[model samples]
Target: MHDELPVQESGPTASGSSPASAPGSTPAPRNPGRADQLDRRGGLDRLGWSVLRPAPVVCLTLVAAVIATGFAVRSSTAEMGILIWIDAHHTPALDGVAWALSWAFESPRAIAVVVLLAAGVAWRCRHLIDGLCAGIALALTWGTSYLVKLLVGRHRPAWTLLRHHVGGPEQDPSFPSGHATFTTALVVVVVMCTRRGWRVWIGAVGCVLAAGVAASRLYLGVHYPSDVAAGIVYGAAAGYLMVRATTLVSHARPDRRAGQDEDELRSGPGEIS
Candidate 1:
């Protein structure tokens, strides 16, 4: 019988020379998959994109335009003329309703509703991209409002009266009411956060509140009609821009990341599985 040669078992590397040539040596190549997994995890577990891509920029631009236009059109005389016209036509009962609405809009109770809603959304949608978008919307509305108010320096109805009188409108210019801005912001924000028919419902509420606040400014004799009009324009611009910004950011977000994020979030909370 021929002498049996000792058989050497071929391990993964065969000659045990290179890790790359080993039987299961493709671990490094699998990094892409792992990275993909992590991306998904991040998307799902953390607030990733903010307000959809180019939205933040677009919103800022739009707000600037509204402010510019509002200031350019400021005229105490025009404001007073509108007040006079409304006062001349509407009944005292209607005015009273407007006044009541004005008070309600600024009340802490109204704000509380918005705060609660935001908080609830945040908690439920922690991993959702939209939560970040919602924050952007709120910030855009509020930031622009204050900036416009300061820049326009429009007087309130309470401080001065509108006069279509002889000397070309009053020097005390009141344009762009804060109350209107607040309500409009709330309405836009509410609409953005909800879906389907909810938008309509939210919009209706917002409109009512905005109108009430605007009317109160007039009733309280603190803001002119023009002020309210400007406020509406400002609010709408902020709302529209915010929505558009959200759209842009959504589009720009990396598609690969979103899926990974979702998967990681669903598979129990840990690092990327």
Candidate 2:
């Protein structure tokens, strides 16, 4: 018999040795659960950076300003003079306008409505981050307004001067007009959250609403000008800072798959053989 050549395995045989992947081949798909975990971790990291970067300084500054204004209003007669001047100039016809404008913010309902609307808009846009930011900003505005009102402990303008006012069984202290605070904060957040193409319209509408709310408080003679002014300042600051934080976090770098795809493309066959 011819000398039989020793049988040699040409490829992976029943022994089960597999071929090594090519050097530049695409990696195996990542585990779905593990990938989601990584994404969540990265999101948290971005959110932390966004919160830590500028929020503390800005918030502290705003808090100091609000505190100073609160003290000044409590200890001085200037604000009273301003309120008296505004009250003296009220017109009967304006009562309807003031009442209508002020009605929305008469309670916490208008703020809640705005928060819901903002969330709805974000959901429509498929941007969950925007919704979260809007909700957080509005909540912060409400909580801060409540705390500051408690801390300031200033009473509302005297009802005797409120001739053109609408109906009320009002009981809240009014160093900072809650209506003004909520409306201003709502406007700021709405404008900031709008897309560039829609920003002008949204901003214009927001300004109209905020101005109407502020003027309504003065016309109703329920809030001193100083109270509304402080509310505007505080609310605007809170909305702006929160929007900035959310924007920073939302702009985190895209998924790693994009980079991987680019690398694969660069390393793909130069010319199909």
Query: Of the candidates shown, which would achieve the greatest lDDT relative to the real structure?
Result: 2
- Give a tens-digit lDDT track for model 2, residues 1-273: 856545442233344443344356643433222112223322111222334667647766985798778877875545666667776777777877888888877666775676685667456545455466567767677677888899988887777654445666366878778888888888776665454456689778888889888988877777778888888888877766665555544444344445344322221111100
RMSD of each: 12.3, 12.8
TM-score of each: 0.55, 0.66
What overall lDDT goes with each candidate model? 0.54, 0.63
Q: How does model 2 fare in lDDT? A: 0.63
Task: After superposing candidate 2 on the true structure, give the runs of residues whose Cα lies further than 4 Å from its correct spot.
Answer: 1-60, 245-273
lDDT of 1 by residue, 1-273 (tens): 966545433222445342343443333221222223324322222112242546546556766776786667654445565666554555567656765676565537546645664565455545344455555555566556767777777654433343322112223435566568767876776565554336677779778777767776665556666677777777766765664555455545545645344423222211122
Sliding window of 10 residues with minimal summed lDDT for model 2: 264-273
RMSD of 2: 12.8
Deviating ranges (above 4 Å) for candidate 1: 1-62, 88-92, 107-114, 123-136, 158-174, 242-273
